[model samples]
Target: MVEDEFATEPFEVAWAGEARWFLQFLSEGAGEVSVRTQVSADGLVWVDHESPALSGPMRGVMTVPVSDFGHWLRLVVTPSSGDPSSLARVYLALKE
Candidate 1:
């Protein structure tokens, strides 16, 4: 799920078996878009994605596939150039 507004961080997930996590997001007002993700076996320790997962001009729904099925996960939007209310408009998808 989205963790914050205009900025999402420390997204979390818990997979029962085989599952996939997807996030759909958008940016407004003409600015670069960027995404970051962090994974963890336990919620306490985190391993951030080496590079920004998503970036560039604002566009339609941007779908991001998270890591392989695991016990816990967290996805975050590292940066943006929009209002929190606007950034809050992110969508998440999952398959189990």
Candidate 2:
């Protein structure tokens, strides 16, 4: 579902305890699009995990490993220059 215009809905880890996580994104559109991962401990204060996890003319798949993320995670997508009607799909998974 379309979570948000700038960010996805906060989601909890699938694992019960501390575990590694990865975010995969598949997008197709024109112009320049960028995506980054964010983490939050309380779900109220969020912070960017690393550099732009994925960036460019969204037209392929990209995977980014998330480390040091708190208990919640989300995605932030930005369009540097592109049709405002562009869209992207995101997927999240975890491994213990």
TM-score of each: 0.58, 0.71
Residue-level lDDT tens digits of model 1 in 1-96: 232323333445563433333434443434445665666766777776554577644545555665463556555654456432233355445556
Clash pairs, model 2 backbone: none
Stretches off by above 4 angstroms in model 1 are: 1-12, 16-27, 50-52, 80-85
Q: Candidate 1 clashing pairs? A: 11-74
Top-scoring candidate (TM-score):
2
Q: Summarize candidate 2's per-residue lDDT along 1-96 as a digit string, tens digits.
A: 222348878888745344333323343555565678888887888998864566666555656667656578888876667553444566676655
